[model samples]
Target chain A: MKTALRPSVALLLIAGILGLVALAFAWAGGWLSPRRIGGAAIADALQDNLGKPEPGWRRAHAKGLCVSGYFDANGTGTALSRAALFPAGRIPVTGRFSLGGGDPLAGDGRNVFHSMALLFRLPDGEQWRMAMDHTPIFPVATPADFVSLQIAGIPDPATHKPDPAKLQAYLAGHPETKAFMDYMKSAPLPSSFANGTYYSINAFRFVDAGGASRAVRWQFEPEAPFAALDKKTLDAQPRDFLFVDALKRLSAGPMRWHMIVVLANPGDRTDNATIPWGAGHRRVDVGTLTLDRAATEAAGDCRDYNFDPLVLPRGVTASDDPLLPARSAAYSASFRRRAIEGPRPDALTQAGEGGAK
Target chain B: MNGPDTLFAFPARLLHWTMAVLILAMLFIGAGMVSTVSAAYPALLAWHRPLGIAILVLALVRLAVRLTHRPPPLPADLPPIQAAAARVSHYLLYALMIAMPLIGWAMQSAGGYPVILWKGVALFPILPHDIVAYGWLRRLHGLLGYAFFLLILGHVGAALVHGLIRRDGVFRSMAGRGG
Candidate 1:
């Protein structure tokens, strides 16, 4: 023996050393016994940057119009989850399609990342509410990273553009952010709301009547052909063209999208919204969502609803995904802030009918 | 004393060089991650997260090999203090190699992020969700990275001294040239 240490002893010692350091880090970094991690604070920080909240507008997705619809469930949902909305029946649905970000007056032509929030009233009175986005992936992996990302995007006061240095630094620090922004840059922006597909982006758990559970994520896939206007045409159109065009499209016929649910394999990640299941993942078609009528933001019932994604029916439960709760907390905070701010006049309605032509 | 041609086992030598390149690459990639906001930021992250986990797993494997098989002892004429310094520094490097990735993984976990190892595979979190924990772990990860980088410099410096100045086989033993 070259040394007094046995191989097993040496191995154990090395493991002990590594473990010791890891334990030290866990203790020092406050990773042990995590509490009050400030999800609420992060939400507050994001809202603070949007200046004071205006009445009748959300902290984000401020430019939105609500529409009424019915979800025609074929009852396939019971196979996966015993949610009451999937009783092979029609359920009342109210939805809002909105522009991304806090500016209520921002034109639809200027935004690419749009949002859709839906509230489905099941027969038994339970509700399923979801706030989803056009993009398939979220920009940041965690709520903390989300805060950093938002803070970094705040434009410098001098240049009216966000400082490249700050963003660069942030990107360097959080590498998981690349896929989201890249998807935004590469994916075609929908020319009309009827043409866009919305993604939940975060995964959840579905428990069937037998108490069996499966990890799943969902997307609203538009039945309409995916189409987009060129930048030249987009620029020439009126600021509120999306809402106007959506209304025109609805008048012509109902707007429809398939509500598709995707299931994850054993090793698939159910917790991270940033990491998405690719195209090869197993999926099932739950039902069709048909939006039959549209109402102005002023007249829509959706304006009063918060649309928290966690409001699920009996069989559907939230997974350990941190974004789920973070989103819930933030949306509530945004709703609270806006509630206190009071209602103001909406810009689209002010321009009168046909203002977007 | 064994001849200057004595060397580490082939697997050890292989891991040494592979990890040398990977560690250096990790440091640079990590530095670039925090400094740029261009379109390439996401691309960098695509490589960063999985690479970090790879380094972590490899480090543990390397430690196993190292603990099981001892490297040839320092030259007989070498002073005790220098020998002790060399041993201490090697352990420090190993400690860093193992710690950095774990802290990063823990940090992400605490921040409610996933440690995606590849396109489809992801490792579970080592810590529970907490933004406050995430913040502290993030800072520590960066600080340890600086320490790791500096230690790497010192490690390279010592290797150069042995290879170029002292004419000892210490560097060559791990370099794969010596027996």
Candidate 2:
């Protein structure tokens, strides 16, 4: 019983114990984790490269046309997800078709990234919102890389084009972009929005009622069929040809897309956004997305929504995809800015009433 | 190892101290995670999650060990009030050790965020995803986290008193050489 220890020694020992506890905590919490990146910072970086965003416009996809429709769940997805929307029912949907750019006036003649965002209203009053892209794979893997790519896109004031040196540096660091660039060279640019297959390139988990789960990615396979146009053919069309073409197509009847859920096999990369899942995987045609009424931002008010891909129903949840939360954070940041800016009637406000951009 | 009548079994002591460190870190990490939306949020979160599940697993093993190998009794000369306080506090600690992680897992599940530990590794949600459930579960998790923190302070404060001031073997029962 070495109670012969002095008061100062005892107090110092106690302090040492507490300090060691704190040290252990810090070592685990700080040493193993990555530096946090705020969504607002991502948005700021995006806007810095893309130009001052049009007031009330989305930070990533500014120019968009709204369409209202319904999703008819075919019950096939019920085997994959326990979500209420999958039980063979019709769910109301509000969708927006947009081009991925900061500028609302960016030429439609140039083949840029096309985006399809959807907001589905479930019977339980919960909303499922997702923003998908025309490409099967995202060009960049992480938010930092995404921002770096955006910075590479920034135009030099004198030259009005990105500095070749910066572009080269980005390519060297992110060969994923180089691969994406190679694919884009030969990839078909959709002649119309209705012709493109929009994908949720980031993976998610679909949990069935039996408590089973699977890693999956989903896409809207167009019923209109795939049609690709060359740059020269696209450049010959009108400046607002994409939107004009959508309007003309909607005049016929409701446009349709099959919701195909692509299953991931064991060992497939779930955290990566740059790699598309290879073929020979099981695909489930889960539902049908029927887009009927087309409207502009003023009329459809798709501008009022965030379309955060993380907004999922009960049966679905985010996977280990690193980009999923980053995308969500960036979307939240962009949405927060739009909330502060307030909705403003843009040049396309009269588009629903037969006006031009 | 000391007899069960003297000190806790070695595995029990090891788990107690190891979990002591993990739980302390978890509490602070949880605090930092909620208090900010800073760039460190995700990093803090990454640590918070794995640590939580680890604590839960350790808690289960600790519980089994405790049930099978009874803890040594308090000192014979201890005052009645202090002994009762010891028993109650110890029980509460065990309850909290298990509850904290279970509640946290449910809260994250309700919020629709998967509790991912590593690349493609995750724990399934124990509860259904409902915003109302998520909202209340979140509040409950926050409340219990503070309660858990306060209990640790009392536990540590008393252990110091027994070791430094009172010079009782109670502190040594878990912290020192074979009792």
**Top-DockQ candidate index:** 2
Model 1 error, position B108 (Å)? 34
| Per-residue lDDT of candidate 2, residues A1-357 (tens digit) | 554578788778777876675555444334334454557667877787875666656788888888889999999889898877788989999889998887776667766788899988775446678899999888888767877788787888887787999999989988899999888777888888998999998999999989898899999999998888777777677666787778778877889999999999988998888998989899999899999878777666476667878767778888887788777768756765665566555435543433442
Give the winner by TM-score: 2
TM-score of chain A as modeled in candidate 2: 0.87
What overall lDDT, based on C-alpha atoms, would model 2 receive against the true structure?
Answer: 0.78
For each candidate, the DockQ is 0.01, 0.07
Off by over 4 Å in 1: A1-40, A231-233, A354-357, B1-179
Residues B58-87 of candidate 2: C-alpha lDDT, one tens digit per residue: 999999999999788888899999999999
Supply the TM-score of chain A against the true chain A for every candidate structure: 0.85, 0.87
Let me know the DockQ for model 1.
0.01
Model 1 lDDT tens row, B86-105: 98999999999999998988
